[model samples]
Target: MESNQTNRALIKATVIALSVAVVTLVLFILPAEYDIDPTGVGKKLGLTVFNQDGESPSAKTSTDGDQDTVVVTVPAGKGIEYKLSMMESQQVTYEWQTSNGELYVDLHGEPDGDNTGYFKSYTVATVESMKGSFVVPFNGSHGWYWKNNTDKDIDVQLIFSGEYIVEGLK
Candidate 1:
């Protein structure tokens, strides 16, 4: 009879441990690491910054500022935008270059509250590479729009440092 009681207690303890592990994984681990927040808690906690490619849109914080390097792919005859969030008077220095050909590029900013389809263009041109620094005039998102007018896809490598948060590819 004592042996039977001992076996039952051990079995109960094992089951309890497994149950706690599963709950923790479903609630915290999956969302924080893999961006698989089934309960939407990870996004609310600002933890789901990684895309499918395992690249995070959030910048790496440093003593001087935030910095990041991102590679964006523009499909043939398509366009894409990479943006960063910044406050008024914040500054950033950036450089981007294409792998092969020139792209129609637009460096611009959109204000934080005006939603009348308005954006302020700082520069527009077709180029293979560009390097510049910008001080935002208002609290808003600032970045580049690259349009590839070719038959093959092109990759653009962008490196930037600033006091900003990356908004990712749009």
Candidate 2:
């Protein structure tokens, strides 16, 4: 009876350990779901309309493209975390993918004494899937710069992986 009880206890321990291992691997494995410090993002990330969905994305779309600016308005909280993809050699080798569709980002103008203007600058990248592959140190670059290269205006839906901390507008 004692030996049977011992075996049962060992089985229970093994089961518990395996369960924990599986959960941890799922959470930390590469290409895992997005994760960020909720406290920081909750405090900072919010939505700002860069442009109405389904429009051409171009540098010209920005109202203040003339001036370069990094328009991060929201203050990041003390504890913020985001799940970023591990840097890969293949990712760096890609042609920066501007052909299919592009989001032209332009620099922003200087404001008060703050150097927010430095953050200004537009970026253009092709939009193949709605995903908009990003290499952000953050979960994602939420906002986008759009261009209406087409004669008629088109609606473009944009989705970013993580929270959008601030909104910058022209």
Candidate 3:
């Protein structure tokens, strides 16, 4: 009879522990750590903005500065250049559009010590507008070179955000 009572007590304790663990996982671990809040509790707590890696979507995680938005013009048959100094693994969001017509764009990056004109190109296209994000692969200046491909003057409006230095934008 004593053995039966002891077995029952142990079983009850085990059940309670498992229940607590499930509750904790559903309420806290799922939402705060993995951004997988099925119960909506994590969203209510303002934790859903974080990713599964515990990183917020708009977090400035490096030496980059605040968001920057700049608008410039590329005269007919003329071109312009702009870039941001960024470190490896840093992230930035970018969106740009031409007011009138199309612009030939070259999005590329050059390493800090590269003086041989060696650069990596992210994209080369004739686009009226674009929006995207990038994770910097190496410490470098990354940006765009736009040439007005239209007959009349064109205005290129660029809007950007993230961890980057806009000290040298032209």
Candidate 4:
């Protein structure tokens, strides 16, 4: 009789653990459903930037797909803005198509800002929270800029990442 009771208790605990794991998998591990059309061009660039000088270390990720989809997301309750910090010896650009199928080209910083002067152009993608999802039509090859203003050389990393759905792009 005691052996049967011990077996029952073990089985109950196992079942409870399995249930908790299943709930977590369904609620947190799955990505949101996107009804976005993956055609066109100029928006396959996935660029991510991070504030290496912050205390908590925050980051924002953006992707420009064929639909001019420049989607940016930050951590919950945080702001995000794409500021181009370029030096005198740098040239950067991002190409995308507008909703009307026109070429949308964007540049960063000023023509004369060395390493210390913050560039002039700014694209605000300030996301307010974690529960955010948005897309914009984009289709092109975005360029980049670099200028070594410091007396010593610097290894600036230009982060670029993305994937485009080519209609049988062979």
Q: State each model's CA lDDT, in order.
A: 0.83, 0.31, 0.78, 0.30
Pick by TM-score: 1 or 3, better one: 1
TM-score of 1: 0.66
What's the lDDT for candidate 2?
0.31
Q: Tell me the spans in candidate 4 whose CA falls farther than 4 Å from its real position.
A: 31-69, 77-170
lDDT: which is higher, 1 or 3?
Answer: 1
Alpha carbon lDDT at 73, candidate 4: 29
lDDT string for model 3 (34-107, tens) is 67888999888755433422423333433554566667777799786777788898887889998888899998
Clash count of each predicted structure: 0, 31, 0, 24
Worst ten in a row by lDDT for model 4: 161-170
Rank list by lDDT: 1, 3, 2, 4
lDDT of each residue in 22-122, candidate 4, tens digit only: 65444433211121213311122221123222222122223442222232222222323333322233233333221211111123333432356544433
TM-score of each: 0.66, 0.26, 0.60, 0.26
Q: Where in model 2 is the C-alpha error above 4 Å?
A: 1-116, 120-123, 126-142, 166-170
After aligning candidate 3 to the native by TM-score, how far in Å is the CA of 112 from where it should be?
0.2
The root-mean-square deviation over C-alpha atoms between each candidate and the true structure, in angstroms, is 12.2, 17.8, 18.4, 18.7
Best by lDDT: 1
Question: How do the residues 63-88 of candidate 2 rate in per-residue lDDT, one tens digit apiece?
Answer: 33232222121122211111112221
Ranking by TM-score: 1, 3, 4, 2
- Report the CA-based lDDT of candidate 1 relative to the real structure: 0.83
**Which of 3 and 4 is ahead in TM-score?**
3
